[model samples]
Target: MNVTLRTPRFILRQPQVGDAEPIARFLNDFAVSGNLARVPFPYHLSDAKAWLRTRVPGLPVENSNFAIELPGEGLAGHVGFHPGPQGPVLGYWLGQPFWNRGIMTEAVIASLDWFFSASQAPAVYSGVFHFNAASLAIQTKLGFTQTGRSTLLCLARGAEVEHIDTIMTRSVWKARPK
Candidate 1:
């Protein structure tokens, strides 16, 4: 899958070998490490390498994984979809330094557009930890609605918690402003 998406301030492209160090740094940030479900604290270069080598390629079983970059800056975030039984699950994370700048929101909106255009997915969904208000806000801004909730054990967090699952269907997507 050849996937490259652009927003006004960011470019969403495929991950390259060089992205490992930056990604590792992003993952190690306390703000990110504490909020995200799978990212480990004290994230390592080797961990980043393994993730890029294994997980990055499997992204968007129907579409692709994208490295989110600000123009002139290197990678600032990541946003993508993974195939699901119903449709696709959206996921994203921005470097802490870039938070509150609307960059992630822009990247996510562009990714959803690409997903709907490239795949047969009738809907896209994402699960946000209860405390991730920023992420919840971003999804809501993109027209995703709270569909349900579930409790899952987060091994990385070493706890069981409730998470809100949000979804946006094709019908709703088609009605969104261009």
Candidate 2:
């Protein structure tokens, strides 16, 4: 897979040693961490370092993550996937400062394009908290259909929240309007 993916206003690149600071900064926020299932509140520098240490730019999407960087801005967020029992699940987050900028939407599309072309998985899946309308809209607009519903324990929220599971099979992706 390519280490660096570019859209008009963003560059999704592999994380380097210097990225820990910015990543820790953005992820440390309650608003950001609250939406993520695994990320804890009060994110620490070590957490960012540990996360970046796991990024393998040249590895498969099932084992990599990217630092979402803007030209003048540093790290805007993260977008990547991890291997799971069900399939390859797509995950992403952006700094609160960068919200409402259509950045995540662009990032998701680019990530999906690369994901579908490179992996053997039959589909890509995403689970969004029911309260997060933005993410729900993003997934729907990108052609993901709800597969089911369940509850997930959110680290930041410290509770089991209603989660909507969605998937975009290879067939659905191909037949969608582009």
Candidate 3:
């Protein structure tokens, strides 16, 4: 869908055809791509275009994806959900230049707030590569608890990596301190 979520620092909107340049530029860095399970390293402009082509509007909220935009920076990151075997899986990434700014935490909070309001799903699933402490911290901060561990293929790394599975149940989310 054409949903636009706003945080105090940035806007989360549907990925656009025009975002290809920035998307490619940011994700091309191995530092950024390496942490993601699905993105390839040396990510190209064409790769960005191909990925953007799949971001069709009018999908259900459970399948929502967003392009995180900063006022002057164009696109700084992305945050979204995709269907997984267990449930709706949340995923996100931020450009290296924007790291340590807490931008992602804000974006995720907004996304989840909207998600829980829009869907009747029982929970949201997410996980981080074992080395991604920052991403895991974000999840725990938002009330997601560890469920177990598994291995996931890292497209950029070209290998399977240990993944820490986490979930946020609807009741847990509703009870979370705002």
Candidate maximizing TM-score? 3
Clash-forming residue pairs, model 1: none
Candidates in order, TM-scores: namely 0.91, 0.94, 0.97
What is the per-residue lDDT of model 3 for residues 1-178, given as tens digits with 9 covering 90 to 100? 6788888888999999999998999999998888989999889999999999898867898888999999987899999999999899999999999999999999999999899999999999999999999999999888899999999999999999999999999899888898
TM-score of 1: 0.91
**Candidate 1, 26-114: lDDT as tens digits:** 98886786666667777899988998886544454454678998877889978877765566788788998899999888888888888
Q: Residue 149, candidate 1: how far off, in angstroms?
A: 1.3
lDDT of 1: 0.81
Predicted candidate 2 versus true structure: per-residue lDDT over 1-178, tens digit per residue: 5578898888988888899898888889988898999898889999988976766556776776777899888889988988766888888999999999999999988887777887778998787998989989999888899989989899988899999999889888877777
Regions of model 3 farther than 4 Å from truth: none
Task: Mark the regions of model 1 whose C-alpha exceeds 4 Å error after superposition.
Answer: 55-63
Candidate 2, position 118, lDDT = 77
For this target, which candidate reaches the highest lDDT against the unseen true structure? 3
